[model samples]
Target: MVKVTYEIVPHDGGWAYKLGDVYSETFASHDEALEAVRIVVQEQQVGDEPVEISYQDESGKWREEYSDGGDRPEVEIIDRFRPGEASV
Candidate 1:
């Protein structure tokens, strides 16, 4: 299973959660941002219906396959600025 991590950081003079280079909308406080992350993580745990999916293969050809709903990625949230560390 793929592992995903949401990193909390300061952005746009406010707090945000980042996954790779993508950042979520800014929240007024760290608590607000953390709450948003919690909501997202909860949503991610919900399984979707198994469905046929299409994707481009390495050869640039379109391919279709059945995706299992149970194959969900493991996710976690990480605080970039731990307690006692200077606030970003």
Candidate 2:
């Protein structure tokens, strides 16, 4: 069982969505990541990728994170944009 870390990061232009990151090495295939995201999104009722979720950690601090499948897309670099402006 590979554990993938999904992060819901803020989009500089459009709305945020689920993004997946691999957390474990148990599964070596991309399909595993996709399956995990499909299940999590369905169960969590998230409508889009990079879904935002809040959870309490051992220290009682609330943490927010976004997660998704590992096989979806690749981000070559971070980007920033003003509202209503076309992405450059």
Best by TM-score: 1
Model 2 CA deviation exceeding 4 Å by range: 1-25, 46-88
lDDT score for residue 8 of model 1: 86
Q: How big is the positional error of residue 37 in model 2, measured in Å on the Cα after superposition? A: 1.4
Candidate 1 weakest ten by summed lDDT: 79-88
Candidate 1 lDDT tens digits, 10-82: 9999999999999999999998998898899888889989999999999999999998887877887888676
Assess candidate 1 and give its TM-score to the true structure: 0.86
Candidate 1 residues lying further than 4 Å off, grouped into runs, are: 83-88
lDDT of 1: 0.86
Task: Summing lDDT over every window of 10 consecutive residues in candidate 2, give the lowest-scoring window.
Answer: 73-82
The TM-score values for the models, in the order shown, are: 0.86, 0.26
